[model samples]
Target: MSDPVRLGDVLAGMATPGGGGIPAQPGAGGTTCNRCGARADWHRTIRDKWILIELGEWPVGAVPPGKRWRVAGEGTAVNLGRAQPSDTCRICHFDVCPSQPAPVGSPALLAQWQKNAWG
Candidate 1:
């Protein structure tokens, strides 16, 4: 097996806002793909036994949120159930580390960096 890609490499061009917070879409809370600049879906796995026990079998809902990707141009969403690590671009299908930490900088700088890297 190959080594996992670092998240920092993927978010190289995306800027961190003034508060050093990730820019997410309203309601969706998704960040732009570092490869294609399209919305990338994310999900957090709840593996804590104590939290699961406290919430009971049903937990937060009948089913936990699963990983999904929105297709660029097509505007279609694909649900990828719990599986291996995906560090690829949803639109371009290029390898990218989406789990890595984002870089800190202004939006303009980040955008320029991304364009230079991708373009």
Candidate 2:
């Protein structure tokens, strides 16, 4: 099989903050994508386990407001059930991971990203 799509790399330029910071987002992590060996961060979701999010700052309006994630204090990525006016989100790496066996209806923003932002 072919390698998975590194969505982070593909979408880095359009990262919300226009690409700043050591990683362009807080909550620096040691975790790596097992499928592609790329560095990814995580957030403990309100309804599920730790999820891998891209290490870039995605705009608040990039996806549906309800699906946004904001970096809380002390290196924590918090799932905002709905976004505040001044919020940004870290896209789930799985959104475009070419070979990711993403569970059915699993990665919340992937469909929106595909429909709105990406091909």
Tens-digit lDDT string for candidate 2 (1-119): 59886888756733443243323332446577666655668654443245677667766665554556666665455766565657567666666454554324434455533432332
**Stretches of candidate 1 exceeding 4 Å from the true structure:** 1-28, 47-119
Q: Model 2: residues >4 Å from true position, as ranges? A: 1-28, 46-48, 101-119
> For model 1, how big is the CA root-mean-square deviation?
18.7
TM-score for candidate 1, residues paired by index: 0.18
The numbered model that scores best in lDDT is: 2
Instruction: Look at candidate 1 and tell me the lDDT of residue 68.
Output: 25
The TM-score values for the models, in the order shown, are 0.18, 0.49
| Clashing residue pairs found in predicted model 1 | 7-100, 87-96
